[model samples]
Target: MGSLSVLLKESWSFVERPDRLAENFYARMFLADPALRDLFPITMDVQRSRLLQAIVHAVQTVDDPEAFGAYLGALGRDHRKFHVLPEQYITVGRCLIAALREACSTQWTIAHEQAWQDAYAAISVKMITAAAADRDNPPYWHAEVVKHERRTPDIAVLTVRPLQPYPYRAGQYVSVECQYHPRLWRVFSIANAPRADGLMQFHVRAVGAGFVSSALVWKAKPGDMLRLGAPIGTMSLDRTSTRDVVCVAGGTGLAPLKSLIEELATFNRTRWVHLFFGVRSRADLYDLGALNQLAGRHSWLSVVPSLSEDPGAPGCEQGTAAEVVARRGPWQEHDFFVSGSPAMVRSTLSTLSVLGIPRQRIRYDTLTSTVTGA
Candidate 1:
C-alpha cells in the first residue's frame, strides 16, 4: 500500500514476456464470457499489443495524478465505441487481475494483488465518471470517404467528411474503424487542420496483416463509411511558446506534423519552422511535393527531406532524420515535435535528450499505445 505506482511497477517486471500477460488476460476474459469476444476483432494481434501498451503506460503514469487521470478519461471515452457498460469493467478488472497474478507467478504477493485491485477500482471509477460526463458527443462519428488516392504501392491518402461536425485540435489523432474490419480500430493522425469543408485526411500505409490499414489503403472507396472515435492526443502546439520549432517525421508519421504546420501557418510570422521528412528512398518520398509547396508559400517554413538509403538523391539529406537533426546541432532553444515508426521516434527523442532539450519542450505521441496506425 506504500506508493501504489512502485508496487505496480515492481510487480510489472515479474512478467518476462509482456505479450503473454495480454494473451492470458484475453483468454481468461473470453472463458468467463464467450460473448465478450464479439466486441473485438477477429485479428487480435494489434489489439493484444495495444492492451499491453495501455497497461504499461497506465502503470508508469500512475504516480502522476493529472496524467493518469487524463489518460484513464481518454480511454474510458474512447472505449465507448465498444458499447461497454459499467458492469463489464468489473469483468475486465477481474480477468486482468487474474492474468497479472499469473504473470507475476511466485513473486506476486497478496499486497501486490491488493494494490492492483485498489488501483483498478480507482481507474474504473475515473473512467466511468469521465465516460458518463461526455453526454453531448457520440460514441463514434460516422464519416463517408469522399476521396482515396494511392500515393505509392502501400500508402494511400484518404479524405473523409464526417456526417456531423467533428471537433478536434490540429495534432490530435482519432481511432478509425474501417467498414470492412468491424470492431477493429486503428489510430491515424488527422493530416490537416480543421478545414472549412470539414474534411479530414489520413495517411495510411498497409503494414503487414493490419486489416484496418489494408482495408483503407487498398479497398476503401469514395462511398465507403468509416467510424471515428473521439480525437485524443497531447501533441498540439503551445501558443505561449515563442521558440522556433523543429518537427521531425518519418513516412506516414508526417500526418500529425503536417496538421500542426498547417495550424502554425495561420498565425506564425516571427518563428521559424524546420520540418524534416525522413524516408528510406526517393520512392518513399511520397509527399515531398506537397511539403515543398507549403514551404514555398510560407517564408518562415523550411522543409528538409532525409533519405536513409538513397545516398544518390541530389537535394536530400543523406541519413535518417534523427541523424540529420543531431548533425544540425543545438536546437537548444526550440520546441521539438517528433513522430514516426517506433524506432525512428525513439532514436530522435534519444538524440534530442543528448542535446539537452527539456522533457516539457519535447512533444511526441505514443504511437505504440494504439492498435495500429499502419
Candidate 2:
C-alpha cells in the first residue's frame, strides 16, 4: 500500500460509473462479511444510496488525492460502530479488490490490481487500529437507574448514574442491557450533559415492542443495575459560528440534539438557533418546557412544535417536520442538524438537499427508539 490516493484516483478515473463503483463497494463489502450484516436492517436501501452520494461528494471536493485520506479516517472511525473485527478485514479487502476489477475494464493490468489490493490493505490496517483502540479504551457504562421521572404515559426520563463516569460528548449514546433479558441491549443517547458530579441521564420513551424500553417502563426500578456498552454515534456540534443553526428532531430523536443545542445556548454562540420538533401528537412531544426555558434564557434560541397525526392538539403546527422546513424556504443559509428515526433523518436530509443546503453542513445519527418484546 504505497500510495492509496494514487490507486483510488486511478480507479476512480478508470471506472465508467463512479456511482456504481461506490455502491458496489458496499454491496461487495457486506456480501463478503456477513457477520456485519445486522448492523444494517433489510430495509436499508436508502442508507446504501446515501453512502454512494457521500462518496461522490467526497471525491469531487478533493483538491488533491492525498486530501481524501480524511475520508478513509472517518470511515475507519465509523466502522467501529459496527464492531468490525480485525481478522475479517482480509475478506473485506478481497471484496473491494474484486469490485474494483469489475468496475474497471479488463484493461486493469496485474500491476493495477495489485495496487488496488495494496491500497485496501493499508486502509484496512488503519481501520483495524482504530477498532482496537476503541475496544481497548471502552466508554464507561453504569446502568444504574438512580431516579425515574415519568414525563408522560409513554415517556420516562430516567436518571442513570454510571459506576464509572460516562465520558462522552453530549450527543453520543450508550447501549443499556435489559435486566429482564440481559442478551438484549438498547441504545439511548444522553438527554443532558454530564453534570459536575458525573451523573448521566437518558430520556427514554417506552415503545411497546422494545425490550429494554419495556423494562424501564414496567419492570426496572431505582437501584436496579444493568449492563451498558460504551458511547457511540456522531451528532455533535460543528465548528461553525457564522451560519444559522437549525435542529429538526422527531420523537425521541431529540435526545442527542438536546445536548447539542444546550451546549450552544451555554456558549451563547453567535449562530441563531431554531428547533423544529415533530411528533405524532402533543403527548408524544417531551421536554417542551425545557426547550421553552432554553429559548427564553437565550434570545437567539426559538422552538417550534409540529404534529403529523394530530395538528388539532393544544400546541402544535400542522404537518411533518419536512413539510415545515419546506414552508420555511431559503434554507441555504443554515447549518442543518437532524435526528430521530432513520426514516426521519433520511427524509429531513433529503428535504434539506433539495433546499440547496450542502450535505456536509448536516450532522445526524439514526439510532432510533425501539422496544424488545418477550
Candidate 3:
C-alpha cells in the first residue's frame, strides 16, 4: 500500500535477524496455505529448520546482487515442485512479516515492516528475472529415441537424435517424462559425450516400481516420445583444472560418470582418471562393455568395480567403493565426485575427509526428494 521504494529502505534498517526472517517466512507460508502441509513430512519443525538454514546459506554467499538474484531464481524454480503460485508469494510474505513482528516484539515496527518489504522485493526481482532467463534459454534435450538396447538385466541404453542439438558438459543430469504415464518423471544422466554424429545416450535402470521406470523396463519401445528437461547439477568436470579426477558412483549413479569418462577419453588424455563404481551384485553391473572400451582406449583412466555381495565375480574387486578408494590408497592425487544413496554420499564424504581430501574437492549429488509412487 505504501511506496515500495520507501518501504524497502525503511525495512532494511529495521531488520537484523536472518533466522527470524526465515522462520517468519515458513510460518506464514504454511498458515496461509494449509494444503501445503502434506508436501512436508510429519516433522514440520525439522523441515522448517532445514529450509531456513539452506536459504541463509544461499543468501549469505551473495558477493554480487546479481548472484543473489540467480540464487533466489533457482529457489523459485525448485519451488515448482510444490506448485507455488504468484498469489502464494504474497500470502507467504504477509504471514512472514506477521511472524517476524510477533517474534521480534519491540523491534516489530513500521520501519521494520518496510525493511522486510524491501528485502522481499529485492529477492523477488532477482527470482523473477532468473526464472524468465531460464525459460527463454532452456537447456537442450529435444531428442527422438532412435534405438533402445537391453544390454544387461536392469540396464538399457537409449540412443537419441535431437531436432535441436543437445550439447552438454558431461556429468550433468536431465529429467525425462514419458507419455505412457504423463505425470511421471525421473532424472537420468547422459551417458555419452558429444560425438560427431550428435547422438546422445542415456543409461536407465528398471527400479521395478513407478509407472515410468516400469514402462521403460517392460513396455516402452523405440520411437516413443520422451520429453526431457535441460541438464542440471553442479557436479561436472572442468577440463581446465589439472586436478586428477576421481569418480565414484553407486548403482545408476554410473550414468553421469560414464559421460564424464567418455568426455575425458576424447579431450584430456593426459589427465589421470580413476572411476570406482559400486553395485549390489554382478547382476546389477551395467555398461561394462563401454567402460572396458574406455579403459582400453585411455590408459590414464582406470575402472574399478566394487561389488557388495559377491566380490568373487570375475574382474570385480572386493569391498565397498569407498573402501576401495580408501584402501587402494589415499586419494592425494585426485579430486572426487560421488553420487548415490545419501548414506553412501555421507559415508564416502566422511572417509574422504579423514583421508585428507579437501571438502571443496569432493563433490556429491544426493537425492533430495523422497521417492514416491503413482
Q: Model-by-model lDDT, in order?
A: 0.89, 0.69, 0.66
Backbone clash tally for model 2?
6
lDDT of 2 at 312: 81
In lDDT terms, how accurate is model 3? Answer: 0.66
Clashes of 3: 3
Choose the strongest candidate by lDDT.
Answer: 1
Query: What TM-score number comes out for model 3?
Result: 0.71
Model 1, 1-374: lDDT tens digits are 34798889999989898888999999999998787999999889888988887888888778878778877888888888888889889999999999999999999999899889999999999989988988689999999999999999999999999999999999888999887888888998899999988999999888988888999988999999999998877789998899999999998899999999999999999999999999999998888899999999999999999899889798999999988998995899999999888888888889898989898889887753342265
Q: Which stretches of candidate 1 lie over 4 Å from their true place?
A: 368-372
User: Model 3, stretches more than 4 Å misplaced?
Assistant: 1-126, 138-142, 368-374
Candidate 1 Cα lDDT to native: 0.89
* TM-score, prediction 2: 0.68
Better of 1 and 2 by TM-score: 1
lDDT of 1 at 328: 93
Question: lDDT (0-100) at residue 251 of candidate 3?
Answer: 72
TM-score of each: 0.96, 0.68, 0.71
- In candidate 1, the residue pairs with backbone N, CA or C atoms under 3 Å apart (3 or more residues apart, or in different chains) clash, namely none
Tens-digit lDDT string for candidate 2 (1-374): 23544555666678787567656877887777767667654444344544554445344434434434544444465455456677777876677667778888776768778766766665677656655665654433546788887777878777777777557777777666656755445567887766777676677777755656867866778998866665666667865557888889888778877888877766665788888998888877768988898888888888889999985877678888877988985778788888787678778888888888888788765434321111
Candidate 3: residue pairs that collide:
11-114, 11-115, 12-115
In terms of TM-score, how similar is model 1 to the real structure? Answer: 0.96
Off by over 4 Å in 2: 1-124, 134-140, 366-374
